[model samples]
Target: MSDKQESIKQAAIALFAKRGFDGTTVPLVAEEASVGAGTIYRYFENKEVLLNVIMQGEMLRLEQSFKENFPYDRSIREQFSHLFIGLIRFSQENFESIMLINSHTTSRHLSDQTKCDYTSLLTFLSTIVEAGREQEVIDRDLPIEAIVAITFGAVVELAKCFNGGELTLTEDLLETLDEKLWRAIST
Candidate 1:
């Protein structure tokens, strides 16, 4: 993408994160990006298209961050710790993308392919939970999806709290959260 295109995407993400998809407008994004309204059309065919593009890009970024930080050969506890910390770090570094992604999960404009891509990240996390079950580290009675939901749901809420200034993302707090999350699922 060109610099202008990237700028437009960034501006759109900030606007969408703040105003929501339905509330945001192309002219607002263009104004924020310091580009002409027609320039946005050159890059994105329409507002929905722009939102989808931002969502897909952010999803890919999140997926890549998890894959890069995941400790494939480590113990379940260690892997979970890495994953949780990586999530917090990703949220801190890409607050706009995180908010944009959190906002767009239910959007009607997102393509089926984009939804599948997003689902794959959940599946990847589920595999980690499955590993815990296989190793007898996590509760074997609970379904894998439930385990994943509980674990991921907790972390996501914490991230949201941190993003909203309700909680601080201190290192000590992250470690405490990691331990608490592990204890929640572990046998």
Candidate 2:
């Protein structure tokens, strides 16, 4: 990220977090960034483009963090736990940016790559349940698709809780989410 772009992103996030997207404007972002209004135009064609870039940036960061920290060699259960914890850890440290990025995404104008990018919790997690089945650690009768959905879906909601300041993961929300998720999916 260039120095100028990063500064603009930071300012934009702070403004959106405080005032929401509808309430914020390009000039406001520029002023918050301590840059001239024209400078923002140089970086982004419009507010919508800037918002998409920021959202993509957040997903890339989380994907990088997960890719780096996850233990590929661990057992399915261990890996599942790690993924959930990783999300909470990443979100706790990056809530402001993450929340802002999340707000910028909408149902329309969302690319397939971007949709798969920010919220692939299900697709990535179904693999874990499948692994457990292969290892004979999980019952084969359960449907992997629904299991993955319920497990990962709840974690997403929990992350929302953490982001909203309604819940704090005192002992790693992953541990709790992992256990509860496993119980729901396992026989």
Candidate 3:
């Protein structure tokens, strides 16, 4: 993509992350991007299309963060640590992306393809939880979806707090939070 297009995506991600899709306007995105509103139209047919593109791209990036150097041969505990740390690091680096992703997940503007993309990310996490359950390392009484939701919900809330300046994020804090989260799910 050209510089202007990339700028538009970045601006839209920030605005959508902060104001939400319905609260944000195309003119606001153009202003943030330092481009004409018509330029965004040139790239995306409409706001919904823009949101879909951004959501899909952000989902792929998040999934990639989880998959990078994943410990396929490690114990479930170690795998869980890897996933937790990966998410923390990703949120630290892409705060706006995470906020946008978490907030707009259920937006009415999302396309079917965007929904499918989000589901694939969840499926990846569920696969890990399933392995843990088979090994008797995860709580079997709780469903996979519940486990994921609980863990992810905690992390997302923590990220929101950090984003809001309510908490100071550090390596030690991240490790502690990771252990706490792991214990919450591990058997």
Q: How far off is model 1, as Cα RMSD?
A: 1.7
Better of 1 and 2 by TM-score: 1
lDDT, model 2, position 140: 89
Specify the highest-lDDT model's number: 3
Better of 1 and 3 by TM-score: 3
TM match of model 2 to true structure? 0.74
Instruction: Write out the backbone clash pairs for model 1.
Output: none
What TM-scores do the predictions have?
A: 0.91, 0.74, 0.96
- The whole-model lDDT of each prediction reads 0.86, 0.73, 0.92
How far off is model 2, as Cα RMSD? 3.5
- In candidate 2, list every pair of residues with a backbone clash: none
For candidate 2, the 10 contiguous residues with the lowest summed lDDT are 101-110
Backbone clash numbers for all candidates listed: 0, 0, 0
Tens digit of lDDT per residue, candidate 1, span 41-106? Answer: 999999998988888889889889988957888898898888888878888888878778877887
Q: Highest TM-score, which number?
A: 3
* Alpha carbon deviation, residue 3, candidate 1 (Å): 1.5
